[model samples]
Target: MLSIRAVICTLTCLLFSGLALAQATPRAPGLTFLYSLNCTLGASLPVGAGPNGNRVVIPITGGSFKGPRLSGKVLPLGADWGLIDSKNTFSADTRYQLQTDDNAHIFISTSGPAQSDGFIHLRIKFETGSSKYYWLNNVIAVGILTSGNGYVAIDAWQLTSPTKA
Candidate 1:
């Protein structure tokens, strides 16, 4: 009878543990934050001195995109896009942040010429009335980028997240 009770207790604990992990897991289907050399993107991102924040989620094994849902009319990834020195889709390792309001954000890191700091990536997802915007910020840095050089040099910008359908 004691063994039966123990098994039941263990299973119960396992069930609760799984629930906790699920709640903690990040909402999958990551989104991308695009930065333009020009300000015509028409998207805006407001960075608040977030709460006593300390933890960051650096994606190690996942794609940088969740849903292609975007807004504010995607600036042609061609001559209209400034981030690209030339013209094309550049797949770079980026990062993002989440505010207390539950807005999903993505970021990228960059450094000026001849500097030795990592880059930054900031991704944000927001819905305003009937519009969805994505704000992707990139900070320039030295060698590989990390959470330290992640938060600094944030260049604020926004893109469409997706339609509510």
Candidate 2:
């Protein structure tokens, strides 16, 4: 049998722990509109089935992007090495370059799985040394990709703190 003092202490600890957990609960992050990319593509070249999945390489011919912060054109040198696994999920893996209208070069990579809504959800990343657009290097971004007859469109947003104004 526990002592009354021990019982009271345990109850107090449990109550404070519950209160701590309530205060620690995390809120969902918010998103800020980042950019939109519309890219033309060449034909996809099938790479046959590999150990992980069926692979294809789709060339990114050319395109453009616009946003409140920056606008640019997609260079012609990029490709998407996408894969389809046994579960029939398409995983897009792409690396590309963007040339801003002002001539700063930015490199971008996006990877994510296709969802049930027929949209490919993307994790977008960026790299550049230009002082004007260097903020892209630190953002956590997401995108929704839609494919058309000969091109692909991506609408991207940056993750933000819920309290961000």
Candidate 3:
């Protein structure tokens, strides 16, 4: 009877330990589907070499975007201040304005690195005073940028906690 009780106690402890380990495991957060924007970039004007790299200015001519929550036109008058280091990595800092179809104004800025593969990954942020779209002012956004001919396209996604969905 003593031996049998010892075996039963060991099995119970092992089972509980397995359960505890399972419960302590970490979970990864899920990405929610957010909005996307496409932008057009104008010609890149070389600004000579700086201490860090070669400086350049790329104009943000104009573009339009249609997303689930918002659709608008990208206004002109914005430019991308970029630098290309010796490693050939292009870092771009772009600031622009957006005008929604309803006349709401939004300011946007994105900065990121572009490799030789021609893909630019960016961290984007927004500022707006419109009550209808104020949620954009406080969210984290990621974007993938691509260029073709005389245009640049950016697809943006907003990150959200899985629990919040």
Best by lDDT: 2
Inter-residue clash pairs, candidate 2: none
Ranking by lDDT, best first? 2, 3, 1
Q: Write the per-residue lDDT of candidate 1 for residues 1-165, one digit (tens) a residue.
A: 479889999999999998998784453342334322211222212222223222222232212222234312212221111122222222232332222123433322323221134343433232233223332222222222223221222333343334443
Candidate 3 root-mean-square deviation in Å? 5.6
Candidate 3 per-residue C-alpha lDDT over 8-75 given as tens digits, one digit per residue, 9 for 90 to 100:
99999999999998784455555554556666777789998999899999998888987888888999
Error of 2 at 124 (Å): 0.5
lDDT (Cα atoms) of all candidates against the true structure: 0.31, 0.95, 0.85
lDDT, candidate 1, equals 0.31
Comparison by TM-score, 1 against 3, better one: 3
Residue-level lDDT tens digits of model 2 in 1-165: 999999999999999999998895577799999889999999999998999899999999999999999998999998999999999999999999999999999999999999999999999999999999999999999999999998999999999987733
Tell me which of candidates 1 and 2 scores higher on TM-score.
2
TM-score of 3: 0.79
